[model samples]
Target chain A: MYGESKSGMQCAEFDLLMTDAIDGLLTGDQLSRFEQHKTACPTCSAMFAEAEAGLHWLGQLEEVDPPVNLARNIVLATSGLANEGARASLRSVVNTTPGRPLWDRMRDAFSPRTIWDHVRGTARAIFSPMATPRFAMSAGMAFFSLSMVFTVSGVKISDLRNLDLTPRNLTRTYYATEARAVKYYENIRLVYEIESRVRELRRAASTSSVEPEQENKQKNKQDQKSPKENEQRQYQNFSRQDSASVVIATFDPGESVIGESARQRRKL
Target chain B: MEDAQVVELLVRRCIAGDAAAWEEIVQRFNRRIYNICYRFAGSPTDAEDLTQDVFIKVYRTMASYDGERASFNTWITTVTRNLLVDHFRKTKNDRITDSIDAAPGESEDALPLSDRLEDTGPAPDAHLERRETRELVQAALQKLSPELREAVILRDLQDMDYKEIAQALRVPEGTVKSRINRGRAELARLLQRTYRQVM
Candidate 1:
C-alpha cells in the first residue's frame, strides 16, 4: 500500500515527512521529494494546504492581554503579605500606588517574614485539597479507633509521660517488654495444651458411655474373624475414634480449662 | 547578564526568601501563563483561577527548579502544562461542550458573540474583525482534542520552540511535531468550516 510513487516517495512517507516539511526542517533531496509528492498527490496537497492555513490562522490568534488584576491577584495569592481575592481597591493600592516609603516597602515586601508567609501560603494551598471533610472524618475515626484499642489494652496517655529515661532503666524496660511478651506467649500455649487435653478427656468419657453396646457387638463379631482380620478391625476402630474426637474439638464450647483451674484454686 | 541569567538571579533571590523577587516573577509570567490557561481552558474565569494556582505551585516548588537543566521559561511552562493537565483531568466530567453561541473569552477585552452578531453598523472595523477572528479561533481551538489542543497551544500560541515543548510535554521531538501538525490541520479545517468568510 505504501509503494513508491514516480516522485520516489510513498503517500505514507509523504504524510510522515509532511510535518518536517511544514516546520522547514527538510532540505535538499528530502525537500524535493516532499514537494514532488505533494504536487503529485491531491490528498497530501490538500492536507499540506490545510495545515498551512491553520498555522497562519493560529499565528494571527494573537496573545490575549490578561485581566488587569491577574498579576495583582497572583501576587496577593502567592505572597500572603496581603489579603488575597480580587479586592481591586486593595490590589491597586498594593500594586499601583507609587512612592511608598522605602522602609515601609522594605518591611512589607522584602522582609524575611513575608517570605515565610509566602512559603506557608503555598504549602497551605497545596494541602488544602487534602483537608476535605471525608479525609478529616476518616482521620478522626482512625484516631478514635487507635485510642479505643489502647484503652482496652490498659495503655494510658499519662503513662507515656512517666517513662524512665536513664540508660540503665531503658535496658531494664526493654528486657521487661521481652519477658512480658514471652510470658504472654507461654500462657497462651499452656492454655491451648490444657484445652486440647480436656477436650480429649471429655470425648473419651462420652464415647465410652454412649457406644458401649456397639463396642460389645463389635467385640463379639471380632471373635469369629481371623486374628489378622481382628487386628485390622481394631486399628480401623481406633482411627475412627480419633477422627470423631477431632470433629468434637471443632465444636468445643468457648469455656477453657483455665476457668476450671481458677475454680479449683478457689475451692482449695 | 543575559535574560536567562537575570531569571536565574531572580530565582536565586526568590529561593533565598526575597519577596520582591517572587512578585517580579509573578508579574513577568502572569500574562503569559494566564493566556495559556485561557486558551487551554477556554474560559477567562477558569484561566484566572488557574493562573493563580500555577503561580502558587511555582512558589511552592521554586526550590526544585534547576536552571542548569532547563531555562526558566521551559521550567515554568512545564509547571503550567502539568497543572493544566491536572485541571483537565479534574474537570473532565464537568466540562460542557462550548457552543458557538456561548460568549467567547468572557473577559473585559472580548466582545460577546451576540454583540458581534448584532454589529450591523459598517462591516466591523479592523479592530472588531481581529477580535472576532480571535474569538472564532479560540472557539475552534476548544473543539480540538486535549492532546492536540495542548500541542498547538504550546507551539503556535505560546510560541515555545519544539524542543522546549518536548521537554515540557515530556514527549519526543518527533511526537510533538506530529501532534502540532495534526492540531494545526484540525484547527484549520474547523475554522474553515465555521468562519469560512473570515478565513
Candidate 2:
C-alpha cells in the first residue's frame, strides 16, 4: 500500500528524483510532490534511506597511509633518474673530451637499442623496394620462360617432307637380327676360352709326378671348369641386360618416330 | 602554496623532468587518490595499487592538461573515477565492501559532542541506536550496485554537485539521480537485514 505510487514513478524517474533529493536540488512544488510520493511508496522511502547510509559510509572510509617508498619509486620510474649510474659513466666520458656537440649529448642520453630501432625503421622504409627487386625480376623471368616453353611445345608445326613410311614392321625385323648376331658372337667367344683352358689343365695333370701335385693339378682343372660355368652364367646375365636395353631402345625409337612425324607435318 | 599554485608549479617541474617535483606531487595527492580508489575497489591493497597507477597515469598525461577546462583536482578525480569504472566492468563480480575497522580504544560515548554534529543538525548517530548501527549502514552500502554507490559517493562523500557528478560519471543528471536513489534503497534493505541479524 505504501509503495502504490511506485508504478506511477518509472524506476528511472524515481532514481532521478532520489538523486535530486540527495543533492538538495528538489524545491517548491517538485519537492512537495516527491515527499508525497515517498510517504506513500515504501520502495522510494527505502531508496532514500539507503542513499543516506551510503553517503555516511563513504564519509567514514578512512584515508590510509601510502607505502613509504611510493613517492621515491614513482619519481625514479618517471624522470629516468634511476639510470644515474649510466649517466655518470657518460658524464665521465664527456668530461675527458674538452667539448662535444649537442648531437653527441643527445646520443649519450639515448640507449643504443633505441637508436638501432630508429635506424632499422628508416632502412626498411628507404631500401625495402630495392631489396625485393632481384627476387621480383627472377620470378618474372621464370614466368616468361615457362610461357615460352609451353607455347613452343604446345603448338603443332610439322612438315610432310620429313614423314617416313610407318616403319613399325621394319623395327621388329631390325631388332631380331641385331639380337641374334650379338648372341652368336658371344657364344663363339665363350666356347673358344673354355676349350683352351681344358687343354692347359690336362697337360699339367699328365706332367706332374707327385700324388699331391697330381691332386693339385686336378683341383686346378676343377677351378678351370668354373670359368666355363661362369661363361654360361654370363650368357644368362647378358641376355637379361640385352632385353632391358632393347626395351629402352625401342621406347627411344618410338619417341624419335613421334618427333619425325611432327617434322614431316611441318614440311608438308 | 595554494592548491592551484602547487598544481602549476608541479606541472611546470614535471614538464621540465624534475624528479623531486614529481615526488612532492605524489605525496600530496596519494592519500586522497587512495581513498577514492578504496571507495571504488573496496579493497585496501587494490586501492593502493590503483592510487599508484593513477599517479603514474597523471604524470604521463600531464602534457594534455589545459587549465581552462578543469582544476587539477577535478581532472585527477575524473581520471581515478574512469579507471575505477573500467576496473569494475572487468571484474563484474567484485563487490566493494566497507571494511573500515574501528580505531583502537576509540569509543563514541568517550568522544566530544562537537565531533558528532553535522552542519544540518544532530549527527546521523543521534537518531540511530548504537555505533554498531553505523557499521550496519556501511555494510548495507556495500550491497548497493556500483552505479548507485558511485553516485552516492560523488554526491555525498566527495560533495560534488549533481551536475559535476553527472559530468564525472559521463551520464545525464537524471540517470545519476536514478542510480543514487536505487542505490540508496538497496543499501537501506541491506541495513535492515543487518539490523535484524544483530537483533
Candidate 3:
C-alpha cells in the first residue's frame, strides 16, 4: 500500500500526516497538501482510511473500573508501612536522644554484627517449636478405622511392573472404541433372540389359533420381561447422554472393559 | 486541597501513622495510576500488582520527597514511569501481546484481543462490538515499540500535550512528536487489520 504520489508525498509521509491530521498538528498548508495528495493517490487514501478507522476504534475505549477493594487493600498496606515507619523513627529518636556518645550510637545503628545477631535471634525464635501437637480424643478415635488394621500384602517392584500402570481415565480410550463393536454384536444377538421368540410365539399361536386372546396374553408378558425394560432404560439414557456408561464402566473397575451388560443381556 | 498542600499534609500524617490520610491519598490517584499501569502492562492481570508495587515503592521512599519543586502528580507519575520501565526491562522475556503477534494470515487461530477482555457485562451485540473495537485498539497499541507506545499513550490516552509529554519522558519535543506520530500509524495499521478480521 506504500505507493508514491504525484503531489510529491510518499505513502509513509502520508501515514505520519494521518496522525498529524488527527492530532490537529498539521498546518493549513500541510492539510491542504494532504487533501490534494489523498485525492490524487490511492495508497495514501487507503492508509488515511485505515488510520482513521483505527483511531475511531481506539477512541471508544471505556475507562475500566479498578478491582473491588483495591483502595482498601492499598490503604491497609500503606497503614502497615506507616506504623512500621513510626516505630522505626521512635527507635531512632531513642538511639540519638542524648543518652549515648555519638560514635557509640553510630556503631549501634550501622553495625553489621549487631544486625546479624538480631536476624539470627529472630530466625531462631520463629523456627523454635512453640508446643507439641496434641490431638483431640474425637480426632484420635475417628482416625482408628477398622480398615487400617487389615493390611494388604506389599507389592514388589516386579509385581507392580507386571500390572498396567496407566490411570483408569486413560484406559477409557480403550473402552470407547471397543464398546461400540460390543454393542453392535450384542444388538445382532438381541435381534436374533427376538426373532426366535417370535417364532416360538407363532408356533404357540398356531396351537392356540382357536383363541386370539391367548396370543395377546403371551405378547403382553413378553413386553414386561426385565431384559426388554432394561433395554428401554438404556436407550433412554444413551439418548439423554446420562452417566449410564460411567455406571456400566464402574461395574468392573479393574479395567475399563465395558458393554458386558449388552453381551450378557443383564437387567441393569 | 492544592496538589502541594495535599502532598505535604498526607505525607506528614502518613509518616505519623495516620491511616485515614493514606486512604485518601490512595483513593485520589489510584485510578490514574491504574490506567497508566494497565496501558504499560498491556493486560489487566499485571496492572493491579504493578500499581501496588508502585504505591509500595512510593511509601518506602517517602523520605525523598521535596514538595517545593515538582507537584505530587508529576512526582508520582515519574515514579510510576521509572518503575514501569524497570519492570518492562526486567521482564523482557515475558512478551505482552494479544493474538496479533502470530504468523501472518493466521487470524482464525489467533483469538482477538476482545475475547480476552473481561468485565464486559451483559450488553447487546452492538455493545459487544464496541468493546471488541476497544480491545482491538489496545492490542494494536501493544504492537508498537516501547518508546512509541509510551509516547502514544501519554499523548492520546493520557491527553498530555507535546511539551508535557516531552518533559515527562525526558526527550526533545521533536522526538516525542515523531514517536507519537509513528506510534499512531503502527497502531492504526494493526487496529485496521484486526477490524477487518473481526467484521
lDDT (Cα, tens digit) per residue for candidate 3, span B1-199: 7776877788667654566776777888888888888877776657788888889887776555555555667677778888888988888887635477432211225454544443345755876566555656666676777898888777777776777677677888778766776676678777657656644
In terms of docking quality, model 2 is acceptable
Candidates arranged by lDDT, highest first: 1, 3, 2
Q: Regarding lDDT, does 2 or 3 come out ahead?
A: 3
Task: Estimate TM-scores for all models.
Answer: 0.57, 0.47, 0.50
- Calculate DockQ per candidate and list them: 0.31, 0.24, 0.20
Per-residue error (Å), model 1, residue A260: 99
Ranked candidates (TM-score, high to low): 1, 3, 2
Find the candidate with the highest lDDT and give its number. 1
lDDT for position A256 in model 1: 57
Deviating ranges (above 4 Å) for candidate 1:
A1-6, A10-16, A23-25, A81-268, B106-122, B196-199
Docking class of 1: acceptable
Residues A156-213, model 3: lDDT tens digits: 4466466764788458867876998899999999999999999999999788775777
Per-residue lDDT of candidate 1, residues B65-154 (tens digit): 766779999999999999999999999888766655455664446555555656667787788678777787888888888889999999
Segments of candidate 3 deviating more than 4 angstroms? A1-21, A25-54, A84-268, B1-17, B96-98, B101-124, B196-199
lDDT of 2 by residue, B1-199 (tens): 6888888778666555466776788778876777667655655667767877787778766656555667677778788888887887877755423332222112323332222322246455544434434444444454566788788767655677777777777888777776766665566566555445433
**For this target, which candidate reaches the highest DockQ against the unseen true structure?**
1
lDDT of 2 at A102: 62
Model 3, position B90, has a per-residue lDDT of 88
| Candidate 2, A1-268: lDDT as tens digits | 4324553454445556766676688898778777777776776676677667655555554445666776666666655432333323323343233356766656654757445544654565555656687978988999888879867878433653555556885687789899999999999999999999999999887777566787999999999999999999999997686555545545664566556545544554
